[model samples]
Target: MLRFLIIAIGAPLFLMAMPAHGFARLTIDADSQYRYAQSRLDSGAVDEAVAEFNRFIHFFPADPRVPQARFQTGVAHFRAGRYQAAAAIFNQQTVGFAGSPLDNQAFFMLSRSHARQGMIEQAIVDLHNLEALSSSTDVIDQVRYELGWLHVDQGRWNAADQAFNRISPDNRDRFQVANLKQSLALSGAIPFKHPTTAGFLSIVPGGGQLYTSRYQDAATAFLINAGLIWAAWESFDNEQYALGSMISFVGFGFYAGNIYGAVSSAHKYNRDQINAYRERLNQHRQISLSLAPSPKGAALCLTISF
Candidate 1:
């Protein structure tokens, strides 16, 4: 028979009275590994902390602490701004270890990770799940706030209102959430910059932007274009056209970025407006499903078709 020796946490250090006490059995030195990992973490050596914890997990694959180790690993990745890594780890834990003690926290973290990565729709789904899973008042409050923010970002004012309204008084004091709610209450969006001007500028080397009302884009186009103008002027004035030419070449890059930004913003604005319009076209469907009898205790069955 294969014997597995395990070092359990919080277990009594009593001498074993086995007939054959020797190094013949496989021993799991978890205590030492845990201590070393804890020491590294306390020392602020994050890389070493991961290394030690990884070793601990490798040595004790089936230990009860595995879930905790997984959570810590995800946390470490999150602290490092490795959001994709954190999301993957958290997602795996949430799906693979549903009943783990850290599942709620992991799901919350996964939502946050997706938010940071701008996976807005995915973030909303996870946030919704987190809200449902949260038992703590504070977490519930945060879920409402983040849910509101997600809807706001997507330009769903009615949905945003619903989410924001769910915020508890106790959590209303948070600056970020309060500010967002206040802004949303006052105006559904930050500011309405005319996408026409932005788009026009892009279409006509910044002229369209000026017409559409994108002053910033107009300025960028006008300012960045000086290279060609300067080059021509320099060549005309002092015959040192090479410097002006090089500067103009660099100016082309700035012009390109500005144009791209203007065009992108314009299209995004159009999409937003279209979405708003389409939202108004939504129709409500109601279907009622209930058991009813024409006569008391009669054996009657009915099916309604829509």
Candidate 2:
């Protein structure tokens, strides 16, 4: 009885331990690997997360999560400030899986990447594409909202207003839209100096600079030009033809430069005013988004404050 009992227990134990020696490796499945990649990303191990995500995509191309993995990889690149790479990946997501639930989100992200790279027109185009393709109100609203800000950045106030008007009344940023309109109305009053007017006024030596509010430059320009003209006239009166011609030539050069400088100063003044206006409008307003990996799919989360 004792021998039979020992054999029964030993046989079961032997059978249980056999697998360990049989080289049956404990393999991580797609879900576990994907979760690991996501955890790495959340922890700010961006490079590692990208590698792992690529691995998941490469090994589990048949898995539905591959799309999410691809997206997460793009998110990783985006978080790392590799905007071009992020854009490329997001573009693939948009093209490779057209009409998928993630399509709008991918387009939005791709546009964001382009915007970050200072490709504003390209970003606008992508957003317009997303707007046309998406049926979801939420997606359309997001696209229009982004389009409004982009137009604002480009100083297209009318276009921005149109974009803002198209957004649904239920948009959370409706009150902020009112503030934007108020600011846009004030934009007309922003100080501006016309380059052409400045150039034309420069015919009077220092008049252009004075018009542009460059008092010191105006005085300097006037004094220098007056001195050169006086010297050239004196040289001519003294019958020193060579000296008069040289002085006159140099004065003419200065005169031309003064005109060019005045036009440039006007442009600079306008730019400064526009930049300041933009700064005030952008102040206390922001919009940002990212893709969050999940078991079901990737969630595009937008955070906005105005």
Top lDDT model: 2
**Candidate 2 residue-wise lDDT, 1-306, digit = tens:** 999999999998999888888667877899889889989998999999999999998888899788788888897898899999999999988875455556667897899899889999999999999888777777777788789888888888788878877888787474367777777778789999999999999998888999999999999999999999999999999999899999999999999999999999999999999889888988736566645556675576764523
Lowest-lDDT window of 10 residues in candidate 1?
A: 283-292
Q: Per-candidate TM vs. native?
A: 0.51, 0.81
Please identify model 1 stretches exceeding 4 Å from their true place: 1-32, 38-47, 61-64, 96-101, 151-158, 174-179, 188-190, 197-306
Q: Which residue pairs show collisions in model 1?
A: 197-209, 197-212, 200-208, 200-209, 201-208, 201-209
> Mind giving the per-residue lDDT tens digits that candidate 1 earns over 1-306?
123244442233434534255336756587777667757765766667677778888989877666666666676676677889889988988875343336666776788788878898999899887777667776677667667656765677678777867888775655244555454565444344465566555655666556545578677777666545566577647766686566666767766766777766666656665455434422111121222121123212121211
Error of 2 at 143 (Å): 1.0
Residue pairs in clash, model 2: none
The lDDT for every candidate, in the order shown, is: 0.63, 0.85
